[model samples]
Target: MSAASRAGSLPANLQGLWADGLNPPWSADYHININIQMNYWPAEVTALSELHDPFFRYIERLLPHAERTAKKAYGCRGAVAHYTTNPWGHTALDGRIVYGLWPDGLAWSALHFWERFDYTRNLGFLRDRAFPILKACAAFTLDYLVKHPRTGKLVSGPSNSPENTYIAPSGERGWIVMGAAMSQSMAFAILSRCEQAAALLGVEPELRARCREAIANLQRLEIGSDGRLKEWPEEFPEAEPGHRHISHLFGLHPGYEIDVDETPALAAAARKALDHRLAHGGGHTGWSAAWITLFWARLGEGERAWQFFEKLLRDSTESNLFDTHPSGGGPIFQIDGNFGGTAALAEMLLQSHAGRLRFLPALPKAWPSGRVRNLRARGGAGVDIEWKDGQAVSATLRPETTGTHRLIAPQGQRIARIEANGKSVAWKDEGVRLARGVVYRIAFQPAG
Candidate 1:
C-alpha cells in the first residue's frame, strides 16, 4: 500500500494497486465515507507515517472542488465532499442520495490531518496544513447544521448514515434524516479538533468560539430503549438490521468521542449495538468484520475481537489472502478489509487514541505468548512488547521527542518498575517524563 501511494499523484484508492479491468468496482474511486480513511488507519500506528503523505496531498487537491460543491449544492461556506471521489476530484454528490448526500466526508477526511499531527506532534504541519483544512471543514459544519425542532440541538441532515437506511416512526422507510449518529459524531470529532488546533496555533478565536458553541449544541449520542446506540436521532427501526456499514459505531473506533473508561455507558451502548448487528447477521463483509474487530479491541474485549478477526480471515479472505466482499454472484476483492485488519492487529497490541498509551489492551487468549516490534504510539514514540500467558511482561519505549508521556500497563496488570538505560527511574502512576536519546523499559506485575 505504501509503495502504491509513495510520491503518487493520487492516494491509494478503492483498489490500491490492483485495478485489473476497465471498469473496476465502484470505479476504484476514493470512498471518503470510510474506505479511503480505512486505507490509512495503520499508517501512523504501524511506523509508516510517511505513507500518509499521498492522502494528505489528495485532501489538498479536493479542497477547491469540495468548496465549490459546498457553495453550489448547499449554499454554504468552506467545503464538502460526498460519498466518493476520483483522481479528477469529483466532490459533487454521487448517484443516490441514500449514500451520496453525506456532507461530512470533508470533515471525516480532514481528521487524517489531525491524526497525523496527533501521532507526530508536528506543530508546523498542525499550523500550516492541518489547521487550515480543519478550520474550513468546521466552518462548513457550522453553516450546515440546523436547529432540530424537537431536540433544539444543532443537527445535520438531509443526509443518510452512509449506505444505511432506517424506518421512520411514521412507518416511512427513509434514507435521509437529521442528526444521524455517524454524522453528529464526525461533526463533533472535527469541530472539537479544529477548536483545539486553533488554540494550539493561536489563531481564529471567533472560529474557535463558534466551534465550542456548535459542539455543545450538537446532538449527543443516544442510547435506545433496546440498549443499543441509536442510529438516528430517534429510535428508528433499521431497514436492514444486519447492514454492513455499522456507521453509528464510528465514535467507538476511529473517533475518540466514545471511550470504554471515560464514557462507560456509551461504550456499553456501542457494544450492545454491535452485538445486535452481529445477531442479525452483520459483519458479513470483510471490511465490516474488520471494523468490528477494531470496535471490540477498543472496548477491551480481546476474545470478541479475536473472534471477528478469525471470521474475517475465514469467511472474507480469498486464496491470495486478498479481502473479498460478497456480491450477488460471489465475493469481489476490496482493499479496505486488508487495511482495516492490519490496523486491528496493531490496535490489539497497542492503542494510544484515548489520551494514553496502552499496551496489549486486547490480547486474545488464543495468543498465549507473543511479541511485537516497532508499533508507533501517539506522541511520536515507538513501542515494543513481549508477553507470556497472554500477559505483557515487558515493554520497551523509544521516544522521538523528549517529554512527559502517559503509559498504561496491559489489561489486568500494573507496572512493577521502570528503567532508563537499565537504571531505576522515578515515575508516577499518572505518567513519566523522559528524555530523548535514552531507551526506557517497563516491567509489569502479573495480575493477581
Candidate 2:
C-alpha cells in the first residue's frame, strides 16, 4: 500500500497470459460442476502454470468454459454460465434471470486484480479488461445496496456464507442470510478497491463518505463461545462438520480487515474459528485451501503454512491438476484454484506482512532454488525484494516519496534499508538511502 510498491509494476514477460511453467494446469475431471456462481482462481493458477510452458495446450481448451462463465454487471447465479451465449452478463439461472444479484466472489476478483496491479502494472491489461471487471462489479454493488425503509441498514439478502448453515432462534427453519459476514467482507473489499482505483485513475469520483459509511455499518457475524466464526447473527447454527468453504475468513486474509496489528481480538477470533474448522475435519477445497494457506502464512506459521499448501496441491486435483474433494479435491477444476496457489506460493517467498513487506516467511524448509518473477508487497516507503538460489540474495528496494523499510528476512531477521530520490545506493546493515524516494541495494552475498 505504498507508492513504491505500486511503482514497480509486474514484469511484462510475466504479465502476459501464462499457460505453463509454474502454473501447471490439466484437464476437467469433475462429473458435475455448477461453476456459474464465480470462477475459481486457485485452480486456474495451477492449471495455468502447466499451460504456461510451450508444451502445454490443454489449459487453453478450458478457456471456452471461462469465457462462457464471464458476466457483465451481475455475478452469475447457479447454472448461469452454461446457458448464456453472450460474451458477458448472465441471462439466465436455471433458465431464468430470477436473480442477477451482485455476489461476493465476483467482488474478490476485482480487488485481487487491483492488488496484483501493484506488482503487475500492466495498465493496458488493467484498463482494457481488469478495470471493466472492477467497475461493473462495483457498480452493481453501488446500485444494488438498498436501505431498509425503517431501520435504514444497508441490506444484501439472498446472500450466503456458504460454510455453516444457521438455525433461527425462533425455530422457523433458518437459511443463509443476505449480506452475511462473508458477503460483507467481499463487499467491503470491493468498495475499498474501488476507492483505491478511483484515486489512482484520477479524472473522476464516487461518494467516498458513503463508501466509508457502508464500511462502518457493515455487520460482522458474531463469534460463538467455541471461537469459530459464526454462520449468521442468530443462535448456534447446525454447521457442516467437514465442509471445505471458510468463506468468512475473507476479512482475515485477502480483504485484510482483521489482523494482529489493528484488530487483535477479531484476528484471534478468526484464527480460533479457522483452527477449529481445520481440527474438526473442515476440509480445504482448492480455493478454501488457498485461503487457509494464506492465513497461516500471514500469521507467521511457516510449517503449518507449508502443510496447508501441500494439502491444497496434493489432496485436491488428480495428478495435481483438478480439485474434487477436500483440500481442493474436485475432479473438474475451478479456475480460482490457479490464482490461489500462485498467491500462496508467492506469499511463502515474500509477504507484505501487515503493510511491511517481509521476505520468505512460510517457505518449506526443503524446497530450494525458485524464483517469483515480479511480486509486489506494500510498505509506505520502500518496495524491497531479494531472490536467487531459492533465497533472497540481495534486496533491490525502491522508496516511494523517499522513505524507509524495516526489512525482515528468513528466520525472523530484521534490518532497516532506505531509499532516496529513485536511485539505488549502498546502504549499511542498519540503514542507508536517500529521503525523497530512492532505490537501494541490500546485498546478502553467500559465503564464498
Candidate 3:
C-alpha cells in the first residue's frame, strides 16, 4: 500500500540515525516525544566522551516515567483534549496541541515513525507499535477538521504557526495565517497514509472521502504577495525583526510538499522570505538553523548547507544538546530542535533533494573523515552512499521508488552513462553513480 520505496542498499549501520560530524542520541527522544506529557526541554547536551555515559544514566532515570506517561496519555488518543497545562491552568496555551483539534504533535511523531519504518522496514515494530498509532492519528484528524465557518471550507483554524500569531482584523480572533500550514501538510500526509492503511484494513469509501475533502480544503495556506509565499494575509503582518518558528516554510524542505520541481516560483519566494528573516536579525534559534540547513541544501548551496549545520548545531543547541544562541533561551534538550538539527545534518551528509538521492553532496570542509550508511531520503529511490577524502567514493542505488531518477555526478558533471530498469543510457560511463559528492538537481520525472 505504501507508494514511497523504503528499500535501499546502504550498509545497515547508517540506516536510521543521523551522521554528520557527531552523534546525538538524546535528540532521538525529542523526535518521538516519548512521553508527550512533560514539558521538559528534550535533554541537555554536553561533552561527548565526558557526558554520554552519565546522560544515558539520566535517561534511564526518566525512562520509567516517560513509559508510564506515554501509555496513559499520548500513545494515540491520549491527546484528547487541549489544555493550558496543570493545576492552576498555568501553562501558556498556544494553539499547538489538542485532544481533538490540532494534531501537530501526533503528526510530527508519525512523520518520524514513517521515516524510521521506511529506513528499517522492520515489521515487528510496525504491527506492534507505530502502524496502530498512525492509523489513529489519521482518524483523529478526520474527525477534527470538518469545516471552517468564515471560509466555509475544510480549514483547520485556531491553530497558530507552531507558536506564532498576530491579532486578526477584528482584533478578537487569532487567525492562523500559517494556521492551516500544519493541517494542510497533515491532510496530504494523512490521506497518503490512510490510503496505505486502507490497503491493509480494506477501509471503505467514506474513509477516503474525508481525506479528499481535507486535501480540497487545503489550498488556503498558499497565499502569495508579489509572487512570494505570503507569511500572513498581508494586513495582519509578520513578526517584525523575525520570529523563531519557520512554520511558514513548512512546504520548503523536509516536508517534500513543495519543491522546485512542483512549486518552483513559490520555492523561490520562500527563499526571499528566508533572506528577509536572516538580514533583519531574525536571530537563528536551534530549529531555525536546522531549517536553514535544509533550505540551503534544497537550493544547492552545498557549502552553505555545511556551514549552516556547523554553526547552527554547534552554537544553537544547549549543553543538554550540542550548542545554543541567546535570544530564545529554551531547553537545551528539546526534541523539535534536535529533529531540526538532525534534518540539517542529514541534508548536509546526504540529500535526496530534487529527485536523485545523493551522499556527501554538501559536506562541510571541516568534515572529511566520516562516513554514513543506510540513511533513507525521499525521492522514492533508496540509495546508500559513502565517501573518502571528501568526495563520494561509492554508492548503490535501488529503484524501489515508483519514480525515475537520472543520476548526476559530483561537481555538477554531465551525466554521460546511465540506465533505468536495466536498459543502458548511452553507456558513456553514464550517470557516474549519482553525483556522489555534490548536490544534484532533478525533476519529478527524470526523462530519458
Score every model by TM-score: 0.98, 0.66, 0.63
lDDT of each: 0.90, 0.51, 0.48
Q: Pick the candidate with the highest lDDT.
A: 1
| 1 against 2, candidate with superior TM-score | 1
- Off-target runs (Cα >4 Å) in candidate 1 are none
Q: What are the per-model C-alpha RMSD values against the true structure?
A: 1.2, 9.0, 10.1
Our model 2 lands, by Cα RMSD against the true structure, at: 9.0
Q: Which ranges in model 2 have alpha carbons more than 4 Å from their true place?
A: 1-88, 91-102, 121-132, 146-153, 170-173, 220-222, 284-287, 320-339, 364-394, 398-411, 416-439, 443-448
Comparing 1 and 2 by lDDT, which wins? Answer: 1
Q: List candidate 3 stretches off by more than 4 Å.
A: 1-103, 122-128, 148-152, 170-179, 200-205, 233-235, 317-321, 325-339, 353-356, 359-374, 377-393, 397-411, 414-448
Residues 134-242, candidate 1, lDDT per residue (tens digit)?
9889989899899998879999887889899888778888898888999999889989999999998889899999999999889989999988999987787889999
Residues 13-72 of candidate 3 have per-residue lDDT tens digits of 111223233543332222222122111111111101121222222322333333344345
How many clashes would you count in candidate 3?
26
Give candidate 3's whole-model lDDT. Answer: 0.48
Query: In model 1, what are the clashing residue pairs, if there are any?
Result: none
| Best-first order by lDDT | 1, 2, 3
